[model samples]
Target: MDLDALVARRRLGWERLRVLSRQRHLDGAQADELLDGYQRVATDLSTVRSAAPDPSLVTHLSGLLAGARLRSAGTRTFSWDMVGRFFVEDFPAALYRLRWWWILTALANVVVGLALGVWLYHHPVVENTLLSSVEVQQLVQTDFESYYSEHAASSFATLVWINNAWVAAQCIVFGVLGLPVIYVLWQNISNVAVIGSLMHQHGRADVFWGMLSPHGLLELTAIFVAAGVGLRLFWSWVAPGPRTRLSSLAHEGRTAAGVSLGLVVVLLISGLIEAFVTPSPLPTWARVGIGVLALLLFLVYVFTLGRSAVRRGITGDVDESLEAHVAPTAG
Candidate 1:
């Protein structure tokens, strides 16, 4: 009940715990002693809180306990090992696990874009409504091709990376709402369709594909992956299977976060291709080949490495040690 008396009684033990916690290394016996001291001091703090109610003593004990807890638990640091594990295991495993979602998303968008391009090509009136004769001529002749080369390569790459990354992030973050992801995809695909239709109509289809195919393939795939992952996050709560809705959402959300991070690197690669390769003096075939190669490597990485990782029970989630503790439920 007496604060002063309690402090006097526990001071030696508290000091011992502090010393153990601050030690860079500890023997088994010293570790045990530290644990015992931690328990006793915790009890003392509780008693002082109820009986003595001394704020200063409470604060000191709280700080001491926090240090001890950290020492006991240890700390994780950034390392090459962590980066290797993430790309090899976590990121790809996530992509493989959710492959169907993004694949379907890619397919649907392609279909829509193609169908719209065809319709717009046939309906000259639609293009007239969207762009005047001069505007169309300018876009087909100059704007489409010049846009890529208008800026410095490094700056253009950075700009494209930021813009694409933001779009991908939005797809994941707003995926839970369902409609927003679709809206984002529609806006992207429709613009492409309109431009492609106009280019083909004006007999500049070569210019359009030659410029776009160099970076658009991988860039668009990364976006599809984000949209798919986002839709999956939304579905986690919608159809949670046997798990509670909250639990399912938490699991998928963690995976989605990892996917978002991985997409940053993917978009960066695509951005580089867009800036350097797309507008390079290289032949159109060589440029498109580079883009095709990049997409193929990404796909192979996802299917081969990702599939293997997923088979080993990696769901692209954070380490089990990092996950929140879930209460066990009986079947």
Candidate 2:
């Protein structure tokens, strides 16, 4: 009604609005509440005074509304580096904590081999372990040519690749949990011991070269790399340097896990070639060549490739993300 009362109301309104308006962006609820409050106040002011509303105040309010709209427009965008930071910070640390399983597994690795070896040494007639009757039957009944002919050559090859990868993945992943690591070591020990005993008995030490030379190089190296990681895990807890067992396991497990997964992938690739290709009835020279190729693949992955991948991942958020995702996939 009075000029003084009118100005005071306008001043109070502007003051509160200013407090909320300071932000560059306004949320929907806040902006709506503010706009409604100002609209009512403006109506009252227009009645009390002939003067128009201040343009500067209006511009400030408008700017906040515009900024809020801008914020909403780009809602779907996200930082690519987010996942990189997670794997680098979270997954590796998880692997580190899991190292103890690796450590325990390494110790038990030799048990199966020795058991198989000793048994084969005494029982000259036994050609392989018949621990499971079903396994023996499956091996005996398997008709390679019939199975191979049933699927298209390429289809069979692809299927074998996938199966090998799955098996390798299972071995490497479960090994970290310690179950596969023990089982693998047991299998290897039993199997290798038999081979050793057979070689010794038959005095055909060189036969190992022919029987194992081809895909064996890659397959065996992959197993060892996995075992090495397992051993590293064991040593972490056993020695633990100065730290507690848990603390040691946490740190080493991380380093060991990347290596373990890499090993699995390597084994998968090797197994695929051995199963689906490698000429099935590979000659001695071809087997040796494949074995050499497997050795080279192992060397490249362990020393040059795996190191670089992990390094790029941990170096920075961006590089690690790229390395973790794009590089391994492309390779």
Candidate 3:
């Protein structure tokens, strides 16, 4: 129990831990060694604090123990480098892997919205049931368009971003339930279809298309991506393939979370357009063209850059160190 003896016995282990703590990366064996050393050093610090109470010795051991604890616990530091990697690699690769899911979701929602719009245009009664004569007229002539310009551009952008982000987040967070994803999609599409049908029946299809296209293209796409991720989570539980159901769900869940975060930026761009470009006095073609351009850029990022990332073995999931970390199996 002599403090000098104790220090002599443990000082080498503590020094090794200090060395390992400063490393940028640790091989598995080194990581294990760090953990063991961390525990021993922690005990040494406690013993020295109680038995010796030497300020300098306690301070040195405390600092070394703290660093070792961080190294052993895998502390993450936020950095511009990590941010760059996420956008350049993680986000796009996640989108690429889930491209089919989102693409299918986008296509199906668009088709349903169009079909419903067409059906409602033909069925005046249905449109009337949804909106009375006064409501319909107001919606077509003023309310629909005024809604975009009623607020300051910046405020409107923030408002739209928050609302849309909430929707997207809900789709991902509630995706495990399965039916919620379907219900969310249905609610979104139904609202658009109702509005579109009413506008078309009122002979203001031009207004509807013009106002909607300036932001709807990208906005709707982001929503579809959220829905796709959510549905995939649900399906992961239903069919995990080679992975255990929990493993499949967890992997998809992490990727889904990444997609959710990335879509926030995507939705912000769309919101800005809806607030600024959609309502500005720019020519209809110009406004729609801006929206189209934004959508095209997103598509290219997901498909083009994403494909390359995927081919490079990136799937927007956590790195192998954090994954199951298993060695490859023989087929």
Report the number of the highest-TM-score candidate. Answer: 1
TM-score of 2: 0.46
User: TM-score of each candidate?
Assistant: 0.81, 0.46, 0.79
For residue 47, give model 2's deviation from the true position in Å.
Answer: 59
Residue-pair clashes per prediction, in order, are 0, 13, 0
Find the candidate with the highest lDDT and give its number. 1
Rank ordering of all candidates by TM-score, starting from the highest: 1, 3, 2
RMSD of each: 6.7, 15.8, 9.5
Tens digits of lDDT, candidate 2, 267-317: 667666655545356677876787797677555533443344445544111
> Candidate 3 lDDT, tens digit per residue, 1-331?
5878877887788788899999999999999898888777767766666666778987787688667766666768799999888898899999989888889999999899889888877888977776679988898899998999999999999999999999999899999999998899999999999998887777888998999999999999999999999999999999999998998998999999899989999999999999999999999999999999999999898888788899999999987655542322223
* Pick by lDDT: 2 or 3, better one: 3
**TM accuracy, model 1:** 0.81
The C-alpha stretches of model 2 lying farther than 4 A from their native spots are 1-122, 125-180, 192-211, 242-247, 280-282, 304-331
Ranking by lDDT: 1, 3, 2
- Model 3 residue 278 CA deviation in Å: 0.3
What tens-digit string does per-residue lDDT give for candidate 1 at 8-117?
88788899999999999999998898888878877877776767667787778878887887787789889999999999999999999999999999999999999999
